[model samples]
Target: MPSDVRRTTLLTVAVLVWTLAGCRTVNRGLTEAVLDGEHARQWHIRYGSQSFYSLGDEGLAKIEFEGLIDRERVRVRYQRGMQGQAECVADVTTRLIEQVELRVGMTITTSTTIDLLRFDEPPQNFDIQLTVEPNEFPLPLFVRAGDESCTSILAQNRSYPYVLMHELVETSLAARAGGRVLPDVGYGWFGLGGSVNNYTRWFRDGLANYAGYLACEILSDEMDCPECPTRVAPLLHTSPLSRLATVRTRLFSWSQSSPSEHEREHYNAALGLFLLIEDRFGQQTIRDILADVATRETVDGRDLRAIASQVIGTDVKQFVADFEFPMIGGVLTPVTRALAANKGLNVAEGLLLEFVEPDGPADRAGLRPDDVIVAAASAPVADTIDFELALLRAGRPASIPLAIWRKDAGTIDVEFPLLYPGKD
Candidate 1:
């Protein structure tokens, strides 16, 4: 009898241990499921100052989450705030998830005084799936090229994916919507320090891959021929600023003396060559072409320039001349240094004359048009004299600094570190 009792006790203990382990596993799964659900149902919102280049005075965002619980009650809650202000609205609960979403929408307006710049498309609704009591984590979902979808992780964690997707979609869509036909042709605008910065952010959040990123980097300034389909486009290219550096010298000349109609036509022709290569060849081919060109190798018994001539039946110089057109207005101008005569440095005639020079110290320093000069060499010059003083002060050799104000954009305080001037 005692032996029978001992055996029964052992069996009961074993069963209890197994049941406890199962319960723990179920509990952990449930927690993860809940977290994911919270992430998915939340509408991740972000906005910037509507006008571009207003760095300091832009309104940040306040986040909120609204969702249904067990397919019945609606729950709305404020997730977080920025800069110590709690901008969230009063939380509300209801029986419908739709109502929860609506209520959350109402609170968004109250969070900011200025009209927030919203994404072209924001998630207005969610497709909820019902699962067992203990839910499981979902697999990674894929986004199509130029298309994006928000997941629970992005929504709940307040991840930057939503903002990044907006940029990607906006950029791709904007390029498509722009006058340019070939997608690669749009690469010129997208291949800049700014574009690369945004691209990196997008890649980190799983919005982009190697191809698009590299294309943007190589073609930032060559707006005429924007497309470049290559592994570089998807992969991060080392220098987004490469093209920008070369562009500075051309800026002053382009801006001061208008390109002759003939020259303009030539530049436009070159742009056309870019468009053709981008449209006909895949990104990999472009990469191969660039690699061959860089290494001074021959393809099919011809050098890069020669191969280009064979493929297009025209030399690089001729091809550039054919497509080149007069410099179009409204493109970004290269910046260069000008010292104030009395207070701010005067823009040197040469620097001012050049429309753009990509890497010139003046251009790299970010000077804009119609900027008033205030000081040079960190010294305040107050005497308001005639034109001679202004010109003389501008020529001073000490590394200059200037405070300038533009009409639309605000004032900028800048300094240019002088380098040994190359053969100018």
Candidate 2:
């Protein structure tokens, strides 16, 4: 919640006050400061909402750059040249944003702004700052993390695309909800506050982080969040990936309200609940849940639990309880010590299907009893843990791929349909 709260968009008034101090301001490569009076006036007119207001004269050097991705426009304003990132950062970040939009079946067409700020002295020294206004202005994107500039972050983190996507997706959803359901949340990126906006912190961050990881996974062929994904390191000891859901996602008494301390990495719980939903219903259900949030303006405001439950035709509280998510499903076994020796597998080279329930996910994927899964989701599975980890990273899919070694068929690939619990 604190990490998400760092996005508090005090950009406007903060910049105004800082610039008004009238000395030791950033003049590095900033076009605004050197513009002639008339052009400066016109320049301020165009971008004054970004806090370039009331500057009669000053010296600052900044960078102006723009790019398009998947037909959406992106603009970046910076106090220093991005060096090489200036060429590809916007395109990469915008594409990640586009992926999140496409995944949710929604598109926020508003142009986005990325601010790369560096404060060299006083009140803040050697720090990074973000500035933006989505509703008040068209720039709905801002990212702040420690003292690293956005460009610096990109250069340092290969997974920076995920960070950019997280900010954009969260802001976009906030904008859509603000524009529609919670009109009282005010305009601009600051629209993320209110009774309803309380949902913005944990749940919103979770969903955004989930969406961002998905996009990152798709682009990189793996989920590459340096600090995340490891939260799932405890390769599930639960049922098989081919199991049936014994419990359904129906609303319960406890889910009537959204809990504030609901911080089990909303990302983790959400990923579980949603993947279960995806396995049971379909991936389309995930899109439906988000779409419902964006365009929905019910009497209860934008309640995620209700919206997800409604979409999944069940409830959301099950996952919220102590941040617990069901890992219940079918079962797989590590190639037994004897079996590994018999099969010449040195280090848990594969998993054996102990029981593939008839008409279950395994059966639907053409898995049969005694089958050996050598790989899952394109990764080699050396044990039950590997297979489960693969399944976890793959999320829930109707047709996740599996490669198995059958006594009769050798190594063959199968498009496994991962169904969830409930024959319903």
- Cα-based lDDT at residue 2, candidate 1: 100
What's the TM-score of each model vs. the native?
0.18, 0.44
Residue 328 in model 1: lDDT: 11
**Candidate 1 residue lDDT tens string, 74-159:** 11122222111111111111111123123211111011111112233333332323221221111111122222222211222111
- Cα deviation of 28 in candidate 1 (Å)? 84
Using TM-score as the measure, the top candidate is: 2
Off by over 4 Å in 2: 1-72, 77-85, 109-112, 115-127, 134-155, 176-203, 221-264, 298-303, 318-424
**lDDT tens digits by residue: candidate 2, 81-195:** 4433433556665666667677766665445554443333112112233343553222212223344443444433333455555655555555654522222232345665333
Show the lowest summed lDDT stretch of 10 residues, model 1: 106-115
